[model samples]
Structures are given as structure tokens and as C-alpha cells.
Target: MLADPMVLILMYFVLPVWLIAGFADWLCHRATHIESTTGAKESLIHLLMFVEVGIPLLAAMFLEVNALVIAVMIVAFFVHEATAMWDVRYATTARTVGPIEQHIHSFLEMIPLMGLVSVVSLHWGQFLALFGTGTERARFDLAWKQEQLPVTYVAIVMLVIALFELLPYVEEFFRGLRANAGRLVPAKARRREAGDTAIR
Candidate 1:
């Protein structure tokens, strides 16, 4: 499995590209000052999309690539697509999504599909068995990879995800929340200011 070009693409190319794209997307959000405009609501949506893709990603990394895993990947890709649409629609309403961000969004959207295709290619027999047409039998049981990925590589990936993807987004959410909180003015304070103005 390790020597296969498809697996190589998945491990060396697809994974790194996806991580880079995710970090780039986060930078785009920061550049647009999403915290001030769309606020935490938009940040929340971003986190949701992260989880949608993250689940299948983790599955593929650790679990055996079987019918169940392929099915999860396919379903997740569609769900991510729907969430991406929602994110753009909501984001455009309140923030400026410039050309750079738009391009980054394109990467963010397509990388998962690319990864899914590679996975299906690597596990073609299982994928075909999914629809009952393949020579191989479909296995849906959840089991770890027979030969696990190198510990150092998995550690690096997890660190990158936490530092680049997860932490940055979580910080973005808090920034949005704090910005929104600061904008809130009490009705009583407003009325008091209004009365004072009348007296002047």
C-alpha cells in the first residue's frame, strides 16, 4: 500500500495540499476581518465545515479503507459542499470576500473531492464492492489500519491541524464573539444618553 503511487499521492500530495489550503482559507477569513462583520455566527459555520471533513479524514487515516470508509467519505464530501455554499452566502451578506479569498475558497472546496477520488482509486475494489459489482467483497467493519502510518508523520499532521487549522479558527470565533460583545449597548444607557441630550 505504501509503494502504490495512489497512496503516495494521498499521503504526500493530497494531505499536505489540504492542510495548506485549510490554513490559507483561515488567513483569508482573517484578512477580510470576518470577526467584525459576520461575527461568531460565521465562525461557527466554519467550524462546522471543519468537523464535516475532519471526521472522514480521521477515518481514512486510521481505519481500514473499506466500503464503510468510502461511503463516509462520499457522504462527507457532499455535506461539506452544502456547508460551503451556506458559508459563502452568509459571508457575502456581511463581509467582503475578495478575489484572493474566493480563490482560496475554490481550493478549500475542491481538495476534499480530490482526496476522495484518490482514496477511491486506491481502494477501487472496495469502492466497486460498495455497489455489488466488484470482484472483492465489501467489508464494513471498523478496524485500524493493518500497517499504521508512521507515528512521526501522524504527530506532525495533528500538530499542524491543531496549530494551523483548529487553533486559528477557534481564535477567530473568540475574536468575533468579543467584537460583537463590545458592540452591544444597553437600552437603558441609550435612553439615559438620549435624555441627557434633550436637557442640553
Candidate 2:
């Protein structure tokens, strides 16, 4: 039920914190001049990570939180983590991933896990069903939430996501693309350029 404390925390607290962290991460990227350093490749990786996490998040918001949904959330979290590591590895090859960005990254990485824990706690029965330890059979079929979140609230959240998270990243990608233009230099090449420029 939406009134449940765990659900409330996941919906209001966890979700907002995640969004804020996401926007903050974008700010960090801009501050570090991601367009000039990491370029569009890194921006693409960012969009990939967003979708990896977004699919399960949308499902959780719109669908029933059953064994199948819980399973999806768990899987998505792991996939997102892997992608995050890839993102950082590639990024650090080209730019300085400073402490502020690293701190923002910590929140981005862990908030999904925290939200998953909250969801599992709220649907303990369904989570147990996934492990075959519950009284009810595990539900793998997707179904709409019986008690839906308010339409206005969902709309507002979606608007915030598009405005704050999605659009800004999209713009970042284009900025990188425009800056790179015809340049297809590798990360190592770019780093070498920076080093050579420093030497001169």
C-alpha cells in the first residue's frame, strides 16, 4: 500500500535523493569539462547507465511490486553497477575524476541499492517468494499497480526527470559531440596531448 512507511520512504525520500544526486553528478561533469576531456563517448556511457537504471525504476513506479519486479530491480542494480565501473574506468583515462565527482558518484551508485532494500522490505512476502520461502507463489507476470500513485505526482516526477536529468545529459552529449566534431582521437591520445601541452 502507498501508505506503508517503507513505500513512502522509497517514493518520496529515496527517489528525490537519487534525482538530486543525478543532477549534481551532471554539474560535476560540466565543472570538469567533460566535453573537452571525456567527450561524447563518456556521455553515451552515462545515457546507457541512465536507461539501465531507469527501466526498473519505471516498472517499480507503475507496476505491482511482486517477485518479478523485485527480481528486475535486483538485476538492474547489478547491471548499473557494472556500467558505472566501466564509465569511471573510461572517464579516468581521459580526465581528473576529482573528489567532489567521486562523492556524487557514491550516491548515484548506492541509492538504487538502498531503494531496492526499501522495496524488498515493503514486499517481504514477494521477495521471499522469489527464493521459494514464502506462502504465496512467486509472481513473474507483470501487472499494473492496484493502488496507483497519484497521476499528478507521477506527472510531476516525470517532468522533473526530463527537465533536470534527461535533458541536461542529452545536452551534455551534444556539447561533447560538437566539441569533438571531426576529431576521433583515442583517450590515450587526448591524455598525451594534455601532457604535451603541459610540458610546453
51-112: candidate 2 lDDT, tens digit per residue? 99899999999999999999999999999999998888777766778889899899999999
lDDT of each: 0.83, 0.86
Q: Which portions of model 2 show Cα errors greater than 4 Å?
A: 182-200
Clashing pairs for model 2 are none
Question: Which regions of candidate 1 deviate over 4 angstroms?
Answer: 182-200
The alpha-carbon lDDT assigned to residue 123 of candidate 2 equals 87
| The 10-residue segment with the lowest total lDDT in model 1 | 191-200
Error in Å for residue 37 of model 2: 0.4
**How much is 194 displaced in model 1, in angstroms?**
33
lDDT score, candidate 2: 0.86
TM-score (C-alpha) between model 2 and the true structure = 0.91
Instruction: Give the deviation of candidate 2 from the true structure as CA RMSD.
Output: 3.1
Please, what are the lDDT tens digits per residue for candidate 1 over residues 1-200? 77888888888888898889889988888887777666777788899999999999999999999999999999999999999988877676566677888888888889899999989988999999999987999999999999898899899999999999999999988888787774422222233322121111
